[model samples]
Target chain A: MLLLSACGAREVVVQGNFPKPLMDPLPLTLGVIYTDEFAQHEIFDEAAGRAESDWLVKTGDAQVEFWNTLLNGMFQEVVQIKDSQTLEAYKNTVDAVIIPAVADLQYTIPLHTNIKIYEIWMKYRFKMVSLEDVHGNENGDLSIKPDQYFADWTLTAYGKTPTAFLQSDEEAVNLAAVVALRDAGANFATSFSRVPDIAAWMAEGLQPPPAEATDIQRLEND
Target chain B: MIRVIQGKLIAGLVLAMSILQGCVNATVDEMTFLEPTEGIGDASVVIIGRRHAPDYETEFDFIECIGDHIRRGDNSISVLHELDFINMMYPWFEPRTAPLRTDDIEKLLSQERVANRFEELKLEYMIWIDGSTIETNSSGSMTCGVGPGGAGCFGFGTWGNAADYEATIWDFTDEIEVGRISANTSGQSYMPAVVVPIPIIAPVQGTACDSLGDQLLKYLSAKM
Candidate 1:
């Protein structure tokens, strides 16, 4: 049993620190929902051939940590809700809610490619919903429901590293995963306001504060 | 007698080192667009690798080697590490969002945050390095076999390695490309085995790094 377990699969827990984006914050209280699957996401792949080994990659913790830091930097205020029920309780306090999920993930190894590189590709789905009318219950507690979604969009990211730099396959995969995550964060930070739906939503009342509004010192300290 | 023995040891060590090192041929080409009028002063600079290419990513160790060489060569210049500067600027220097041209840098600087950080670092120049060391050619092979009495190997193997790198210096203070330097190096490595394999490896990448680094230091330190 021990020998079998040893040969079963190679496991890699993605680990890396993500930097906060340098940008002016939007003036809005944002609510974020992290579903269980998204928070504990993992990928298991079976060996495709004799030259390959089964892989188990866990990137959930890094994803959660990265998004948390990025969103905090992108917005004036960010609230993390426990679940859907909790989101209802905080809906009145926030302008809108965003739910992020991992839509798909794929990877390639040097053994599979002619170039000595390891690559990882990730896709993310974001659902942005607006709050409906706020109502007070008998206890004076505010209740609100999620209304029409302001935006539902998908984002794709890619990362690759050369085998010459890394000594082991696990390390290469971990680095590639981190690179892809950073890429996704960069793409989202730079293109978020450009999304048509997001643009229209922000156009209603919120215009990103001018360049002077950004806190450069604070970002540098972070 | 003791002095003679120490001298002999030192001479033997030098001979061994020379024997172990393979032959390397290096060529460097440099062009300066804007000459510096004054010393670098208290201003700092960053050397970052370009990883936007689809086929290859510049080796981080090579970039570090160049930075180390420059720092060791000059004491007045401040060299910010590649990873630190990239992280300090965050998304702006990322592989996907990094500026591709000098004009793009102007656009990036227009962003107050990026410009603020650039000023905070006292950054005067940015060196964007791109290229990689590759195994260009290989010939011969080695076969090893073990016997019950003892293990022995007999064969020969040789491979050719080449490193091609280019460094583009961008003067952030002037918001223009100052100059470009390129280093090309190649060498042949050999491994011969009688009972045990003896490998004489070529320092192709190291040669390129040293050649490029020396030229960069001269350019940065030049006052005319």
Candidate 2:
């Protein structure tokens, strides 16, 4: 009975924890914005080199919220803005803005007589530019060009029985996509020092030391 | 009444001995598959057994026979043993059990020295064979020892052997799977010794090699 019971059952879950920043967090506030096409679900075709409308994923806001929370926990400060247009409003408040897009999202489910395999792949592209650069107010004609970064992730799972196979396949595909996006978000939080111009600007913008309180009598004597 | 009971006891003893007797024969089961590889002709391929087998060292001759069959089937395909390839490309490795990432392959290809070396060799594919043939079941045993006169064995024995192997093909240029062929051969054998001796052996490894080699040949052949 035990052997027969075990033949039809298996479970696997893969999730990566965000790593600590290698260097101290940059003393810079940042804004994040998603593209207008972000919410629209797209099927990326490798042969065609284009994306078409497919299954809709209504969790864009939730995903943005997750990144906002994760970045805030990792960095000095991060604010999730509505879109690119809204990024201009935070020019003076935040030091830089990041535009992220889901460039590719797809999965393949291979069927077998007694087993099933599901593989999910995702690619995310991020563009980062300082607020001053976006407003065309460069510091002494030295413009900071936007930096681009890409993260591609693939995840797979296997199932044995028909019912369990379908359920696990769906779960694996969805979880893989979500985890890939979140991982890219976490990576973005700790990658400021990689860009030379941003690193230099951050170094110059370090916060001032706090003033210590002094006793009233000592102050008067001084 | 005493005579009848003695007759019945002898009959029961003979039945038990007959039930426990061993004989010499073999049985086998096999499975094979082939997929089309459209343009993989004349590619350089090396076959090797994994270093870390469960109990026994992998029989290299079995794989050599497979390589021979593949060469005979396709004259254009270049085949080499793993040791020769390892000697040539001493520093680098083609990992087994996991797919190599394209980015990593690209990095190796991007280096000027490695790229030049790779251009010289133009090695593009690999076949990793892993698994073992083992004795699954055995019953009854024959014992023999040398005395002043000679050796002798007193009993009978039988055993079942199983050979399971999986061969994975990799395309280095694309960093993807060309195909996978798995072959399993299982059989049983027996040995009996009374005055003279008789032994039967199951060639599980040979059967696996032949079956897997044929599958690889058909799989790599271009689609019509």
Candidate 3:
């Protein structure tokens, strides 16, 4: 009877809040870049081996894809640059570059208990380097240095049976990854619209292009 | 002996109470607003999640339920779900350590891209939702193991769940906080036979959503 009383399921509470965008999001052309090696950001456990099965190795790809899907329409433009060469090609086209890496991903099922605790996290680095920084000025003089910005976000999820914990270890791990990546993508998408420094940079780059003669004439006619 | 009978009776009563507690429903602890709510007749308002919290299952369902209830009160007010809102304004603002201040709202309006959309949508208000439903406490346990045929769980247990939510209303036209509504609810569930877990608690999330939605409409009513 005493054991029965103690065996009650532990409360499963997954709590967090996503903030509303303070102001309208800035209209800036953004690029997402992934290095050759880091592109496959698979998670590993303490045993120095892959945390999940072979199927889960591509989880990192999903995160990057999610970021693009979210940011594509929200900003003026979002470009996906998979390698350094492509990043170089788009130097003049994009206003900023974002590199997201999976910082941590692990799922552990304790030896003594059926409960499984899974965790997933992502880290993002941002750099705003103008075309002038790389190609030099009209006079072929490299006058301005690249302005750099870095932001790191991590999300952890816990699953203990009867509520938070799911039925299988795989399921729990997948759930954690999905939740963590969702937040990471959300944070990355809105970073420039909220962060003071980044927002300023975005605003500076967001000056409206000179109106065309036809556009002006149409407006005047209206 | 009579004494023995009394001891059993007391134990039975305690068990009955514990089990019955799970069936109680949830309710709104308190909801408050500052300035009088303006009539939002025919304006489109959206309910969105806070950009910083961890999301769980049924998150959208929770928000949708509230939206449905709010719409039920005033059919004219178009309530946009979180997904629709996000689609309209993707790449939301960054996660804030704290809620946005007046200055933040101004900055947002300064962006032509965002401002134009708000104008196009005729968005009048935004309700920011933050909170979750979690298991708070539990007693008893169940054991499960895999056999040759399949895996199964055995044993009996009971647990408690608490649903807490806070909704803050932001008036876009005025660019100020109209009011704040919060719901803190508690409930419980029982597993008479380890396999089936039955929920019995007061003020469940459904109740909270409905109550909040109605209260919000009432507060926003021109009649109020």
i-RMS for every candidate = 0.8, 15.1, 7.0
The segments of candidate 1 whose C-alpha lies over 4 angstroms from its true place after superposition are: A1-6, A133-147, A206-222, B1-18, B145-150, B222-224
Q: Considering lDDT, which of the candidate structures 2 and 3 is the better prediction for this target? A: 3
The DockQ for candidate 1, computed on C-alphas, is 0.65
List, residue by residue over A50-150, the lDDT tens digit for candidate 3.
33222333464555456556666456677766434554567778775555444445444433234323454445544443332233234322222222223
- Candidate with top DockQ is 1
Candidate 3 wrong stretches, greater than 4 Å: A1-34, A46-56, A63-118, A125-222, B1-22, B25-39, B51-58, B93-99, B141-156, B193-203, B221-224
TM-score of chain A of each: 0.80, 0.52, 0.55
| DockQ of all candidate complexes | 0.65, 0.01, 0.15
- Comparing 1 with 3 on lDDT, the higher-scoring candidate is 1
Enumerate the chain B TM-scores of all models: 0.88, 0.68, 0.71
Q: How would you encode candidate 1's per-residue C-alpha lDDT over A66-163 as one tens digit per residue?
A: 99999999899899865445656786688876778899999998877877999999999887765443333444333333333457799999988888
Residue B2, candidate 3: Cα error in Å is 40
Docking class of 1: medium
Report the number of the highest-TM-score candidate.
1
Residue A210, candidate 1: C-alpha displacement in angstroms: 29
lDDT of 3: 0.56
TM-scores vs. true structure, each candidate: 0.87, 0.39, 0.58
Query: Residue-wise lDDT of candidate 1 within B122-170, one digit each (tens)?
Result: 9998999999999998988778888887776788999999999999999
